[model samples]
Target: MQAEYGGDLTQITDLDLLAFDFNPALRMRKFIGESKSGSGKSAPKALDRMIWQRGLRAFVGAEAAELTINSKVTEQNRKFGRELGVSVQTLSDLSRREEALLMAEVEESGSHGAAAFALVEWVRKYTKSEPELEVIFRFLRSKVWFLDSFTAVKQTISVIETLSKQWVVGHEDDHKKAVRWLLAEAVSVFSLMLVDICSEARLRPRFEFDAFVAARLADGVVPSSEMKQLSKSIDKFIAGLLVAAKATPAVRTGAMGAFDPVPPAYADSFAELAWRLSRWVRASDLPRQIDFLAHERIGLNRPVPTMAAQRIQLSNLNFQHSVSLVCAFLRGHAALSPDASETLLNLAVQPEETMSDAVPSDADVASPPPLALKRPGSGADEFRGQDYLDFNDPD
Candidate 1:
């Protein structure tokens, strides 16, 4: 069998090696060997002849037989032998100490030996440190052994951070209270995101108010009726911001920063809401408001418009509304009065009846089961006969 692209060949004969010369500009190299069929008696000798003719720098024979000096056939083997004057050895033989020594000497004298040795030394020096070795090991392990999904990694990191915080704080009442409030606020915002707003313009403001409600809930504050009213006003203000963003001339129809001219009344309303919420947020009892605001901005949910045009129109508006709500609260905090802030905090912190515990009215109660029938009808008669049957009956 003939092998291509660096393969071992053995045991064939009666062949002629033809070297073809091509144009130097073409840069082509070619070797052709041809063998003819012969008698079975001559076949063995033919095999020996072929083996002797095609000797290679690295000769791998089927039976691991050593080639005699006279048996060297190909110019490649002759060149290899002349360069090192080394005896050919199988890889298994070279793995042994004695043969390995001879092989090592041969490798040292080989054409690429110096370059290979330099590479080995370079790698040893550069990768000897613990950190370097660890990095290499990790890279190798990642590519060749371990496979991890990014989603799983992210989830694992989140879990680790959460668990670490919980462990550090343990079962402290204050920590538990904080966790409960956070959960409640998350649920509230999630609920608001699911709410269906009738007007497209109303969506951004509604989302903004939801964010504030979420922040208050996180602070362990129950929103009052006034707070709810203020949230609605804030939503309207955000809607106005959207309208202003839409009016900007430089803003692309579907690109960012299109909104620029918020209505004065809407801006005023937003400022008022921000001023009120900021005071509550800055109070000692609600110090986590900044964190809540950051989280809300990062996590704000946008509603999908029913059409492409609607989506393009709403995108910049939504963004403007979100920015206005956050910026107003951040900038207005210093202007709030101490007494007003204290009152807002007290209102937020005050215990209020939860929806979970709200009592049902009398109308909500089910009426007593309809009075039982005094007489049996056709439907009841079928079962009535069976009910009257007693154990005393005989076949």
Candidate 2:
């Protein structure tokens, strides 16, 4: 991998050795800081700050990975690595043991050691407290466990090697802004890539890719024009997926068989609905909304009793309009097909007076059902409309 850039493998520096030795641990810390926080007894404010920092790491990692995989980026990386004296070695030249050690070392060091250092420096400088920085680092170090494979790690390192040079020489003010924008853009592109991959693989998306997008939109971090662009992009992605699904018989032949055309979690319906809803819902209220809905569903009569019981139960929820509005927004946004939207809307917006037993007995709403779909990533649960699309609901 190193020799691909035309550099002598033996001409390594102490700085390189130090980076290789220490960077992965630093990245592991940052990774935990940005991941979904637990309901642990730690201070919420500090944890919140760490989450964004972790996100920044992911952003950089994704960008580095993308560039490394691109042909143009590959050329640029090789050229730059050659100019910067980055060591390169052909796998054919190394003994099997040497290759194994090289792979192991890269795995240990992580893919973006320099980038992690740069980011940590930014945080350290921003926070202005050495002890506090240590605390954050220690906390993160304790938490991150899931690192990508060796090949993936190498790609991330290549990106770091290429981008770090520009960051090193550019004016501080300009580069800081560039880095900020680059991170955001990279994250957006990464999300698109994930959606495409999920569509192609016919695998249900198990992560909420739009959590940050929802947070940004809610916080007004994104400009109005940009929001419109985002909306358009989302529509286009859904449309393309639909077209692809239609054209490919293999795509329609789900994991089960050709007869089971629709993918799991109502792929063409609720998956898209939840994804788009995640992009639009108020981040703060989403969890509460989800909790309330899940409570209502869990409290409903077993086997739903009858159509009348279901409608009455649905109408009794105080935030029926909010639920209805969510369904309406999804329908208007084209996230739901006409038939699914109509069915969900009917359940959401039905009048309480129309049902024979609009009020459930006092015992009904208080009891939990035999089963509940409360887990966040269960594609089936989110589609039932009982849970608000959490989709990585914000900090």
Which is the leading candidate under TM-score?
2
Give one digit per residue, the lDDT tens place, for model 2 in 1-395. 12234645663311111111112111111111121223344523322333333344353332111001111123444454344333222223233645665543322111124543464455445434445333333222221112222222222223322333333322355344333323222222222222222221122244543332232223233544556567666656655676766756444233222221122222233334335434332322332332223222211101222232332343433234434544443344323233332322333322333234457777665745333222223232323344434445544
Candidate 2 collision pairs? 2-88, 2-89, 3-88, 3-89
The sequence of per-residue lDDT tens digits that candidate 1 reaches over residues 1-395 is 33333437764542233222222121112233333334344443323433543453123221112323222235565455344332333323335854645544333221124643453344335444535343432332122111122122222223222322332222445333332222222322221211111111122354565444333322212334445555556656665675777755333333332232222223334334433322221111121232232222111111111231121222232222332333333234223222222221221110122112358577535634222112222242111222121222353
Provide the lowest-lDDT 10-residue window in model 1. 191-200
Candidate 2 lDDT at 254 equals: 36
TM-score of predicted structure 2: 0.18
Q: How does candidate 1 score on lDDT?
A: 0.30
Best by lDDT: 2
